[model samples]
Target: MIAPARIRIFVDFWNFSLSLRREDDAFMLDWKPVAGVMVAEASQLLGAPVIYEAMHVYGSYDPAKPADGKFRNWFTTWLDKLPGVHTVMLERQKKRNHITCPQCHGEVKDCPHCHADLRGTEEKGIDTRMATDLVSLAWSNAYDVAIIVSSDRDFVPVADFLQSKGIKVIHAAFPPAGSQLSQRCWGNFNVINLMDKFRR
Candidate 1:
């Protein structure tokens, strides 16, 4: 008998999470059921039985902020308890840059409402970390199929490389605004259609 295909899932936390949010700003996802649905769908796509090997979520948090750090701890704890699920957290790097008015291209030093310094903060390293994990897993022969839940085009190359090695890459994205990653993958599955089965 042929062995079942091993399937692994990689989620870009912020990217996936934000996409799931409805217009009303409610964001909730029941991942256990979602995982089951993904595995079943992948099995059908592969035309073979498949085993759920693992699910990984990559994100970043700022440790210096008490509220953010506390929330990360709580969220990570909840995620770690889920079966076959792992959470990888990276430190959010801080950079100070002046915000300029788009119209005049002049530095905007103060917040219009609160009169505070309008330094913008950006989250870095999350995408690079996720890409590294995806490629590393493929090189290690971790799974026969990888289901990626991210809209970022940064992962397009990874998908191409994995497919070149004969591993199937599937993109699980929402409808209407599918990503470049989806076009590069072996198959594209819309999560929006499955929202009723797995969403909270």
Candidate 2:
């Protein structure tokens, strides 16, 4: 008898942006339900363990801290933490942080050119590198495939290099691929299409 295979899976908190961009330019924040479903389905299809870098609410400048005014140092999204109703969401970001690597980790002041929060003007794709380094560490072990769910082209180089190293990119996009994404794929799958079928 042969053993079954296990692939590693990861999701981008930012992938939802492309999904919404499929229909509109603005990013949607309430795709939680959609994202949750995407995770379960991807794992089953790929036969792998999956990871979801916690959701983040940052772009351009910290909305809580406007430019023309005083700097909000506390970085507290909530006005108060009395009941602690939303502490989990707040703490998830408050706990850990990263420097100039647009990691899906916590937010920080960086440069856009280097994913740095410098001057507070880093566009989304400008600074982010994938948070899959831990997964890569695991790769030092033994894994056959790695699946990443994101549409950000910044990951193109990383994905290309991984493929070069014999890793399979299950480039899972939410809204489907535009020309920018299709050009760099050995294979691609859309979770939107998967969910439509999975729900049935």
Candidate 3:
């Protein structure tokens, strides 16, 4: 009997979550079943049975923000508990913006309009981490197929590289957004249509 294809899922958490919220804010994701769903869809496209290996979810939280702390808790205490699911939480790097006051032509330290702190956090190294894992895992012969669950076009190069190595990369795409990445991938499935199945 032929061995089933091993599938690994990689998710860019913020990109996936924000996109989902844009489509339907009320939708709550049930994470555990996600691997099964992707595997089933990919199996049909590959014309072969695939087994779920694991899912690696990458996210970032602002260390200075209370709301982010709550999010971190949910990520570490809750999401990390799910079987076969691994989570990597990174600290967001503060953004440095030098805003010049139009009236005085001097650097504005705070928001001139709302008087709020102009500094904010931005995700750094998350994409690099995801890309590294994708390649390293493939090199390790960890999985036969990879299902990338983000619309980030930055993944296009990695997808191309993986395909060159005889590994199939499936893009779990949001229609019309990830066309570039999808086109480079071996296969793609519309994640929007499957959103309902992930709702809590």
Candidate 4:
């Protein structure tokens, strides 16, 4: 008998979460069964059974933000407990956002309305980390298929590189948003249409 295809899932946590929130802000998700759902869909697409290897989730939290602390706690305490799920949480880098005055081209140091500092945190290294893992794991022959659960177009090149190496990379896509990413992958499924399956 032929061996089942080994499947690994890579998720951009913020991208996936924000997209879901945009679709329905009130919906809660049970993330444990998400890997199963993706595997089932990939199996159907491939016309073969699949063995779920793991799900790697990448995200960042701002150290100075209170709200981010809560998110970080939930991510580590809850999501990290799920079977076959691995979470990589990075600290967001503080950045001073430069706002140019349209008339004089001067940098605005504070918000005009509330006089708040124009300093914010920017997410760095998460995408690059995810991309590196995708390629490195493929190089190691970790899995036969990879499912990327994000709408970010930055992964398009990674998708191309994997396909060239004869690895099947599937995109868990949100329509009209990740259309370019979908086009680059070996196969894609609309995550929005399957949202009900992941509801908590």
Candidate 5:
């Protein structure tokens, strides 16, 4: 009998979570069951029992934001109880960028009447951190198969690299708009379609 593949899962938390919300506002995710289904599906695809190696979820949280910080803490605590699941939280770095009117191309620092600052806050480093971890794990021979639960095209290059190294990279994505990462991966699965089977 052929040996089962060792599989590791990498999830870009914010990207995957927000994408799911965008895809179906009524949808809710239950991670443990989702992981189980993913492992089962991957095992079937490989035609052998698949071993669950590790599942890493990456994201950032801002402590200054009470609501976000509270949720992050609670969510990470829940994730900690799940087998083989690890959560990596980074401090959310905020940058203030001026917003401009599309037609006028003029800085809109504040609403003339409302006096509200038109500054936009952007989160940085999440994608870079995820990519670094993905490559580092591949170099360390962490798993024979890597399942990525994200739809970001930024991961396309990493997927290509893993494939070149003979590592099976599988893209698990939502529908309506699949990603370039899926196209570059050795195989792909529609996560949205499978959500019902794993829904809490």
Candidate 6:
């Protein structure tokens, strides 16, 4: 008897926000729901076992803003609008957005701030980090193909490397821009209809 085909897919959790927005930590941290939705969709198509890993986050800011109150207000409002969080939380954050970034790791400071160390794989770049995770899953497991959704340049290396391994890399990049990751990944690009994939 022949064994079923194998496939693996990895998604960058944080990158989904290029389109969506978050208002508070409550909904922002509860992203497992979103991941579970993707996993279900993928399982229906792949017809094989699948595993998902949480994506790494590496955010870049204008830097000119020095955590000042005015700067904080602008940054928070824009961010809250982007992920497009729920109206309740959106309105809350738009009116009052405060974040503190002390050296402490888990302690939730009344004022929350994000300080990017600019190291580690994800720190290098979020797209690169997601690609790396995809490649890691692909090589370690017995996957026939790997599906990804990103348009960041850092993933170029990951795509090249995955192709070298004879693993199919499919892009889930949407419209306006398609698989900006590079010629490598875009060549295999397969855009999913955002309208169908998103909530109204």
Please say which candidate is ahead in TM-score: 1 or 4: 4
Would you give me the overall lDDT of model 1?
0.82
Model 2 segments beyond 4 Å from truth? Answer: 21-120, 123-128, 131-135, 174-180, 195-200
| TM-scores for candidates 1 onward, in order | 0.89, 0.46, 0.92, 0.93, 0.89, 0.44
Residue range 134-185, candidate 6, lDDT tens digits: 7666767646565565555566677778878876565555444544653575
Q: Candidate 4, residues 9-49: lDDT per residue as tens digits?
A: 99999999898888999978889789999999999999998
* Candidate 6 segments exceeding 4 Å error: 1-4, 20-125, 186-192, 197-200
**Model 4 whole-model lDDT (C-alpha atoms):** 0.92
RMSD values, in order shown? 2.2, 11.7, 2.2, 1.8, 2.0, 13.4
Worst 10 residues of 2 by lDDT: 84-93
Give a tens-digit lDDT track for model 1, residues 137-187: 888988899999888888888888889999999999876555677778999
Q: What TM-score quantifies how close candidate 5 is to the native fold?
A: 0.89
Error of 1 at 160 (Å): 0.3
Residue 148 local lDDT, model 3: 96
Say which prediction, candidate 1 or candidate 6, comes out ahead on TM-score: 1
Best by TM-score: 4
| lDDT winner, 3 or 6 | 3
Whose lDDT is higher: candidate 3's or candidate 4's?
Answer: 4
| Better structure of 2 and 4 per TM-score | 4
Query: Model 5: per-residue lDDT, tens digit, 1-200?
Result: 87778999898888788887887888788887767888887877777778899888887787667898787886689886699988888777546667777999988788789997656456677778888888898899888999998887888888888889999988887755556777788888888778788666
Better of 4 and 6 by lDDT: 4
In the range 1-200, model 3's lDDT, one tens digit per residue, is: 99999999999999989888888988798887787888889999999888889999999999888999999999998998887888999999977766667899887678769998877779999999999999999999999999999999999999999999999999999888889999999999998899878788
Which model scores highest in lDDT?
Answer: 4
TM-score of 2: 0.46
Residue 76, model 3: Cα distance from true site in angstroms: 1.4
Question: What's the C-alpha lDDT at position 118 in model 3?
Answer: 76
Q: What lDDT score goes with residue 140 in model 5?
A: 91
Residue range with the least summed lDDT across 10 consecutive positions in model 1: 22-31
Model 2 clashing residue pairs (backbone): 102-128, 109-117, 110-116, 110-117, 110-118, 111-116, 111-117, 111-118, 115-127
